[model samples]
Structures are given as structure tokens and as C-alpha cells.
Target chain A: MKLDRRKFLNMLLGIGGIGGIVSIIYPIVSFLNPPKSAEPKVNSLKAGLNSDFPENTSKILKFGRKPVILIKTGKDQYKALSASCTHLDCIVQYKQDTKQIWCACHNGLYDLNGRNVSGPPPKPLEEYDVKLIKEEIVVTKLG
Target chain B: MKKISNKLINWIDERYDLTPVRNLLQHKKVPMHRHSVWYYMGGVTLFLFMVQLFTGILLLLYYRPGEDSAFESVRFIVTEVKFGWLIRNVHSWSANLLVFFAFIHMFSVFFSKAYEKPRELTWVTGFIILVFTLAFGFSGYLLPWNELAFFATKVGTDIVGVLPLVGEPLKVLLRGGEDVTGATLSRFFGIHVAILPAIFSFFLALHLIFIQRQGMHEPEKFKNLPEEKKKYIPFFPDFALKDLLLWVVVFNILIFLALYFPWELGNKADAFAPAPKGIRPEWYFMFMFQSLKFLPPHLWFIEGELFGVIAFGLIGLVWMLIPYIKIKNRQNWKYQPLTILGVVAVVFIFIMTILGYIL
Candidate 1:
């Protein structure tokens, strides 16, 4: 094929235009994605002392941007799970009467094991690891 | 210098045909009439919006959006940064003036019946732009995180919550959660800086393209005149120079207002504090805000606020579709219904706005 002067110039212009567009878009796309500093990777948070959370009671504490419910099932036994309901993101509460997690927004229910058992919740609640370190209850998010 | 410029122009003209562009610039004409003054309104609005874009970006350099830092960052800008106060004030004043001139441009088009027939899409696009401009004001208001802005946003979103089925979810989505918090500020910041500007630029481009394609809307009286009797000036230099002169005047006014009465940061928002007395939305929104205030708590079977919202939505829909509305005119009729409706709308808005400030 013959590469005429006009055709060569046109190809160059097209390549230059694409290069210009990419250069403009690269920074914008990168800037829009929040930097690592803005969203700290908080894997573990010291919730509170075990005594403050009595047995059969649950307390919602801020785990980064999300709320984690820490429930004391029994003496020296604790369970931690994400408080955001799978249905609509309303903070789920521990229903002592039913011994289950309940979303008040839509009556979505989850068992003590964080399994979605009933209502509109399509998935189970995420469970976290609970450890007692020097009388402080620490909740660590599991992968 | 002239020879160099001419040579450069010829160099580009050789590579690409510039006839269409040259013809568009040199041959385009703007109608001359008493109402020609209104033509400058749109240009002034566009210029002010450019000012907003420039100043908004400058302020963004120092403005951080978060519950803890939003107010403090703004305070730092005005107090510490060099000429930051001037940039902030220009942004605020120019935003208000942009909305004000947009309203004038819209009303001028309406009174002149320029929205009829071929220019319907132009009107629609222009209407959408006005709506987006108001949304810009509403979203940008909360970025400062001041007491007035926070409370105003709360009230604004609460009004959105009063709608029927979608209201609750929409309000939640807008607030990012149940109530106004740091999350809400982040959402508004993204919307004000990114999403709205993207969509607004698309519609603005379409609006300007349509106007360029069809040229300016000549008044009916001017259109009816003989071709020799009608007067027009070339848009390239004559009309454009006048537009530039008006922009300079408007810019001076904006600077005067910004310098004389600089925008205040007010107190940092305390969510728990009882909202301060006389919490009001911005002046552009006062008409609807005050009208909603005058509504009774309940109107018969339905809630008054809900009724007002629905009524406003329907009225806005009708106004947007006015160009498509066909009203047969009986000969010898005293007044046009649409014209009367426009006048009534103007008067009602003016009265409600005044009452908003006073009562």
C-alpha cells in the first residue's frame, strides 16, 4: 500500500489525538479513586472491655466506615458480626427475645451465626473474629 | 505580527478546510431591535458560569470536604491563603449572578415567544440547564458545612422525604444514610464537583450547538418586516463585542458585591444544636420554600406539603412542554392565556420571594 503525505499526516493526527485524550483522562481517573490514606485499612479495632458488654447483649461500634455489632453470647464467649443488614443497610440489632439479629427496616432476620434465615436479606452477615486481649475486647475483620 | 498571524491561518487552512468555520464566524448575524438587549443576557450567564468554573477549581485546591475539616478548610482559605478570600467570594457571588441572569434569559425568551416551533429543544435544554444550575447551588451550599447551610440542606432533604413512595429512599440516598453527616458532605462534594458538572456540560454543549445551528430567534414583529427593512449586525465582531462589553460590566458588579459584602462562614454546624431561627434556603429557592411554608399542615385528605410538591412538579412539567401546547386563538380575543400565565407566574414568584424574606 502507498502511504501518501495526507494519509500519513492523518494517521499522525489520530495518534496524537488519542495520546492527548489519554493523558487528560489518566490523571482524572486516578485522582477520582480515593487514595490509600483517605481510606485506612483498619483490620482490627479494640471494641471495649468484656465487662462493659454483658452476656446476651449486643453493642454496635464503629469499625471504620461500617458499624460492627459485638454480642456477648455467654461468659468468656463473644460473637462479632457486621451490623449493616444485607437487605437495605439499616443497622441490625440483637433481638434478645428471638436470640437472633433483626433488621427493623424490613424484618430481615439472621441467626447468631450470622446466617440469613428469613425475610428479604439475600446473603448472610459478615462475621468477625473476637479476642480478649488484656481485658480489652478486640474485633478483627476476617477475609 | 499581522503577517505572522495571517501566515499561520493560511498554514492551518491549507491542512484543513476552514471555510465553514470562517463563514460561521463572519456571516452569522444577530437581529437588531429594542429587545436586542436581552440577547446579551445568555452571554453574560455563560461568562459568569465560566467564572464559576475557574473560581470553583481555585477554591477546591484548599477546600477539603469532611465533617471535621470542611469548615476549617474554608476558614483557612479565607484567612491564611493568599487571595483565597477573593476567589471564594467571586465564586459565591458569580454563582448567584449566573442563576439570576439565567432566569432573565429564560423569561426574555418566554415573553418573546422564542421557544415556539423550531427552538423547542433549545428551550428544553435551557430548562434542564436551569434545573442543573439550581441543583449546583443546592449541592454547593452544603460544602461549606456552616450552620445555615447544614440546616438548609436538612430542611431541603426533609422536603424530598415528603413525597409518596420514592421520597424516603431518595432522601436516604441523597443524605448517604439516615441523616446529614460527613457521608452526606462527601456525596454533595462529589455531585457538585464531578457528576453535575459532567452532565451540565453535556446539556450546555447541546444548547449552544442548537442555537448556533438555528441562529438567534428573531422577534415575530421583526420577522414580519420586509427583508430590506429588517436590521441585523454580524455576530463575529459587532454582536460579540457588545456581549464582551456587557460581560465586563457584569464582572465589575460581581467584584464590587464580592469585595463590599464578602461571604461569611458563620458557625460550624452542630447537628445536635436546635436549628437557628429563621433558617432559610438560598434566595433563588426562596419562592418555592416560602410557598411551601404558607401551605397548611393538611389539605383535606392529603398532606399539604405533598400536595404542594406534586402541584409544583405538574406546573413545571407544563411549563417545559409549553412549546408543544396547542391553544387555538379565537379572533378578537383580548389576551393570550399563556402570556397571562407567564405574567402571573412572575408576579407570584416575586411576591413569594419578598414574603420569604419578610415573614
Candidate 2:
């Protein structure tokens, strides 16, 4: 029944362990019933200025909840395609070297026009309408 | 306080019968040798796992599981919530460390032939737990809903899609549809927090119970040494204290990592966004990821990816059945092909992971 040094230390360790466990569980219980958050929603977006995208380069711009890749093929010519690849929905890129929309995964290839050209992609990238209003480039969803 | 506690302990022991447990600890001994360091690996791995469980629970508090909110919620946690960044980083780093030491422990057991005797089920349970730990990493990676995580997960699932007959269905089931979507987020969340933890806990208990029942395996050389010359320490205080010391050292290292190298949050995932350059899996999975990249687009009649998946599956099977294989070959005991294979596998993993970073 005596309070030995070893017994006291064990009691201290047990208390610390309980404290540690409580600290962990508190956050999780709070998270499970989180307060509602206000989220911004958008349908159409002005990606950037026309000069932001140079010739033969690709720019990824957010439209609504997803991203659209705007490719400036030449001076005054631009094409917009949904960035999500058709194969597995990876964001596709404009490869300046290959002059094609390239997927690093599986080497899936799509032409500038969003048509599936090669590899495992079963469908083409979704085409989007691009308009240059004044100097700003705006991207909108296609029907 | 001492008298009250003693009485309470006595009351509980009268019902629960703590005598055998106390006696077992009193009698237990761990052999002391040059290779005694390997014995600590299991305890260290378990300590890291306990850390993971704590940090993971903290993370679950703030991680919103959905395509729309997943990324935002994670960002909010890291950038806004109090100590959220530390919790997340510790959780991630500890997950990596768990896998790291688990691999070391498994290899140590293999080399020591600790999996040879009645301890075969112990090895099996340990291996299953390792697999679940990797699965934990895979599922948790996507919870952040970052750009790299999204694409990497897509690629990972596509690898699963290469299985022969059940491939397509399994892929769909994992992704919760044709692709990684909102459904995929929900599925991964469920698996990471609920399913994987449950499976891991069950197997981990079995592994530990088996170890406790069988005791630490002495190497062949140690078994032949004269009993008078051998050294041992009681498991309760001596060995347990050493294990605690190692756990403390590991905790210090983990804190330093969590503070100095806070886990990076890449750009938010834009499902419609173009894939970024240099995307890769977590370092642990890099070996398999890099190996799959080396495969040709087509191998004979079957697709190259399918071939790679099948090869990896076969390798895993061989690894799981090593105890049986060794026992069957106990008669001849000529060349240790399994040991050689283990070394080769370790070398391959290192090379592939290094190459994954470089190429």
C-alpha cells in the first residue's frame, strides 16, 4: 500500500497517456460535426489577359469547379479544352514540342482540336468556347 | 492514494485474474546479442503506428470528404486550424516511418529465419499488416484532394485496372465509378478511417499475440552457443525500458521532421485541369510506380501494364509463402535461394525508388 517511486512514475505515465489520447480524440469528434462553410461558385471565368498566354503555350484556367486548358496555337488563335483527360481524368497538357495535348500517364495523346489521337484514351477532351473580350481571355463551357 | 489504488487493483484482479499475465512478464526474457537491434524494429514500428492512429484521428476532425469540399477543407486545416499543420505532417511522416520500419522488421525476420517454425502465422500476420499499412498510405493520399494526389490516384487505380478478369470491376469498385470522382473521395475516406484501421488492428493484435506466445527467435548461431555464455534480460523492465527509450528517440526525430519539413500541400485538384509535370506516387510506392513505367506498351498478346501487374502479384505471393517454401526445403538445406531473393528484392526496390526520383 506504500507509494513507491516506481509506482508514482507509472501513475504519471498513465495520466500522460490518457491526456495524449484525449487530445487526439477531441479534434476528430469536433470535425465529424463541422459547422457549415460558405463556398464560392462560378460558371464562367476570365482566365487571364491575352498576353498571359504566349504563342504555342498552354494555360490552365479554372472554370466553375474544374479547370480548362487554353492553348494559344498561333497569334490571335486560341483553343480551349477541358483539362481532365478522358482516359482517367488527369489534367492534359499542351506539349509545345509535340504540338499535341499530351497525357503523361499512359502516353495518351490528343490533337489541338481535342480529338483523341492515340493511346488508351477512349474519348476526346471536352471542347470549350474561348472568347477574347478586349484584352482579357474568357473561357466558357460548351453546349 | 496508495492504499485506495491497491484495494482497487485487488478487486479488479480478483475478477480478471491478473496473476498469469504478471507471471508471464516476470518470466519473459529477451536474448542479448549483436543482432538484438533488429528486435527493436517491431516495437519501433508499433510505436509509430500508435502515433499514426493519434494524428490520423486529429486529421479526420477537419478533413471534409467530398469532391467539392475535400481540397478546401484540407487547405483550411493546414493554413488555418490551430496545430493542424503539425498534426497532419506528423500523421503523414509517421505513416511513412511505419512502412519503413515494417519493411526492415519483415526483412530481419526473413534473414534470421524467424518465420521458420511455429511462428509462421506470426510472419503471415505481420506481412498482412504491412500490406494494410501501404493501403493506408494509398487511401489517405487522396484525402487532401490535391492535384498531385488526384492524378497519382488515377494512375494508381489504372494499374489496378490491369488485373485479368476482375480488373475492370475492381477498378470501378475502388474508384466508385468509371473515374476518380466525388464517389471516389467518399470511398477512400471510408476505407482510410474505418475499413483499413479495423483490418490493421485485427492483424496487428494477432501479430503481437503470436510474438508474445512464441518469444523472440534466437538466430541459429545463438542457439548453438553454450548456455553459460549467453546473456538475457527480463522483458518487463529491462527490455521494455529499452523499447521505451527507442520510442522516445523516434518521437524526437518525428517532431523535428514535422517541424522542419512540414508536409507540402500541392496545388488544389482541378478535375478538368490539365495534368501537371513530374507527377509521382508517395516515396513508398515509387518502386512499383517506376517499375510499371519501364513496361512496354504491349507484351506479347497481353497489354504491358496487365503483364506488370500480374508479375507484381506473383512476387507478392512468393513473399507470402516463404515460410512454407523454406520448411519444404529443410531436408536438403543447400543454397539459401530465398535469402538471395530477399537481397535482390531489396536492391531492386532501392534502385527503382532512386530511379523514380531521377528519371
Candidate 3:
């Protein structure tokens, strides 16, 4: 191929422009992808003393950006699950009457084991491991 | 002083070959007609955006973004910093006015049929800019980290999650996780100040270049008039001065609003708290929010909110491509289909917006 001075310069400018644009875009794309810290690695949180948590009662505790529900199903038996509804991120409340998690925003229901039972929730609420260590209740996120 | 200024201009003109620019400014003309007032709408919007940039920067000097400090910083800004309340108020008021003027500018363009043929790209670019302006408002609304803003953001992002495939991921990306948190606040802060401004400026530059190249759109009546009968004024001194006068008038109104109705920094956001009653989106988004609220839970096979969203998307796509949609005047009707459609849209928006507030 016969390459003229104008054509060569044009090719160089085109490559230079592409290179410049890529250089600017690469950092931005990576920067916008949230860092690991953005989703805090909060694996376990103390949910107060097990003695204080009465039987058949639940309390919502802060777990990073989400809320985790700790339910005292029976004496020395506890369950922990994500409080955010899978449907729309509305915080779910533990219903003592139905013995299930309920989202008031859409009336979605989840079983005590975090299974989606009814009403628009496409997925189940996330389950967390509950442990009692030295009389203190601890909620650890499940993988 | 005039002699020195003329010499400086001549020196630069000789080196840079500024004749094209000089001719552009000197020879450009604005067509004068009944709809000439609408021409000032875009300029007013631009002026208000400038005000937003100014006051936003001033607020940023004291504003901090975090779950812990966002509300506190805003409180400090209004209560501690000198004239901070005024700056914050001006910023909030100017942001609303900018959106208001942009809507007027868009409607004026539509009714005047200014988006026809060669100006199609202008209309498209303007539409994109308006979208980004709303994004600006949405992102900025969360920066205060108040209860209203917190729940509003949640509800807004929830609506985004209602879409099918891309919706969930987009919602996660916007929120920076599974939920709206300090991470979301930081993300919105970056978007409101840096990302949005950079993108908005690029489109704005293109929009302005297109307008400058095309001059102002002449109404059909003005276009049909004979050259001898048609009226026009020089764009540089005559029309430009009028635009500046309007900007001055608008600036006074902005000051009046800021002084009389200061923007409030409500209660701080509490993640565990149940969403407060009567949670609503901003005024510009109220029409859509209200319409979505009116939808039944299930519309046929699809969820009602999802259906509403999809409908809005399709309608917006058609509206953006209005100039390209060719409809044959089969009946030779006096009123064009597009014009009638525009009127219907205006009426719908007005009624929906009012209902959004009152109901």
C-alpha cells in the first residue's frame, strides 16, 4: 500500500485519539465499580445478651447497610435472617401472630426459615447463622 | 481605552484568523414572531444551571457525605457557615427553576414544530440533557441525607428494580449494594457533582453548537412570509441583550424565592425507622410517581408498576423520534397529528402533576 504523508498523519491522529479516550475511560469504569469496602465485610454482629432476648420475640439489628432479624424461637433456640424483603428492599417485620416475616410495603411473607411463602417476593430472605457465645447472641451472615 | 482594546483585538485577529467567529456573531439574526418569547426559555434554563453550579460549589465547601455526617454537615452549613442558608436555598430553588424552564423550552419547541428536519439532532440532544438534569436533581436530593430523601431514594431505586433483566443490576449499581446506605450517598454525591456535570456539559456543548449553526427556529408563519415582510433582529446586540435582561429578571425571582422560602433540612435518616408517611418524589417526577401509584397491583400478565414503566419508556422513545415519524395527511386535516399529540401530553402532565400534589 502507498502511504502518503497526510494519510500517515491521519492514522497517527486516529490512533492517538483512541488511545487518549481509552486512557480516560479505563480508570473511570474501574472507579465506578464499587470497591470491596463499599459492601462492608461485616460478617458477624453481637445481637445483645441471649438472656435479654425473650422467647418468641425478634429484634432487627444493623448489619452493614442491611438489617438482620434475630428471632428467639424458643428458650436457647434462635434464628437470624436478612430483614430486607427480596421484592423491593423494604425492611421486613417479624409477625408474632403468623410466626413469619412480613413486608408491609407489599404484604410479602417469608417463613421463619427465610423461605418465600407468598405475595410477589421472587426470592427468599437470606438466612444467617445465630450463635450464643458467653451469654451474648451473635448473628453471622451465611455464605 | 477603546484604541488599546481595538489594537488588542486586531493583534489577536491577525494571529488566530477570527473572521469566521466575528462574522458568526455580527451577521447572525433572530427571527421575530409571535412565538419569539419561547426562544428565551432555553437561555433562562442555562442561566439557572449556572446558578446551580455556583451555589452547589459553595455548599460543597462545607457539605460532607456519609451515613454519619451527611445530615450533620448540612446542618452545620445552614446554621454555622455565613450566608450558608442563602446559598443552600438558592441552589435548591435554582435547581427546580432549571427543570421548570427546561420543560417550558421543550414544550415550546414541540408546539412551534422546531424539531423538524435539520434540527432533529438538536431535539435529541436537548432531550438527553433534560434527562441528565433530572438525574442531577435525583442524585442531589439524597446528599442532604434527611428522612424524606432517604425514603424517596429507596422508593425511586425500588421502581428501577421493577424492570426485568437490566433493572436489578442497574439498581444494585446505583445503590452500590443491595440497599441504599452510606455507599449510596457517596455514589450519588459523585454522580451529582462530577459524573453528571461532565456528561451534561458535553451534550450541552453539542446542543448549543447545533442551535448556533441553525440560528433560532422560525415559526411556519414567519417562514412563509416574504423576505421584505419578514422581521428579524441582529442576534449579537439586540436578541442577546434581551436574553440577558430576562436572565436578570429570573435571577431576581430566584433571590426572592430563596429569601422567602428557604429550603429545609429535615430530620436525619434512620435506617431502622419505618418510612415516614406521605413519602413523595420531587415535583418534576411527581406525575410519573403518581401515575404509577394509580396502577393496580397486576395489569393482565405483567405487574402494574412494571407495565407503567415500560409504557413510559416506549412513549418517551416515540416522543424523541417525533421529527422522524412521518404521518401522511390522509384527510388533509387542519391540525397535525403531532400537534394534537403534543397538546394531549401537556394536558396529561398538568392534570397528573396537580393530582400528585393534592391527592
B18-47 in candidate 1: lDDT tens per residue?
Answer: 998898998899999989999989999999
Query: Backbone clash tally for model 2?
Result: 6
For residues B76-183, write the lDDT of model 2, one tens digit per residue: 988999988889889888988888999999999998899987888998888899889899999999999988898989988977877878887778778876667788
* Model 1 chain B: ten consecutive residues of lowest lDDT: B270-279
Which candidate order results from sorting by TM-score in descending order?
3, 2, 1
DockQ of 2: 0.17
Candidate 3 Cα errors over 4 Å, as ranges? A1-31, A35-65, A68-87, A91-143
Error of 3 at B214 (Å): 1.1
Taking all chains together, the TM-score of candidate 3 against the true structure is 0.81
lDDT of each: 0.87, 0.85, 0.88
DockQ of 3: 0.20
Tens digit per residue, CA lDDT, model 3, B1-359: 99999999999998998988998999999988888899999999999999998988889899999999999999998999999999999999999999999999999999998999899999999999999999999999999999889877987898898999988788888998777889999999999999999999999999999999988888888999999999999999999999999999999999999999999888998888655546678999988877776776577999877998999999999988888999887576999888899999999999999998787
How would the candidate models be sorted by lDDT, starting from the highest?
Answer: 3, 1, 2
lDDT of 2 by residue, A2-103 (tens): 669889999999999999999999997555432333334665688788877789998887665566888998887899998877665577888999899998
**lDDT of model 1 at position A23:** 100
Give me the displacement of residue B36 in model 3, in angstroms: 1.1
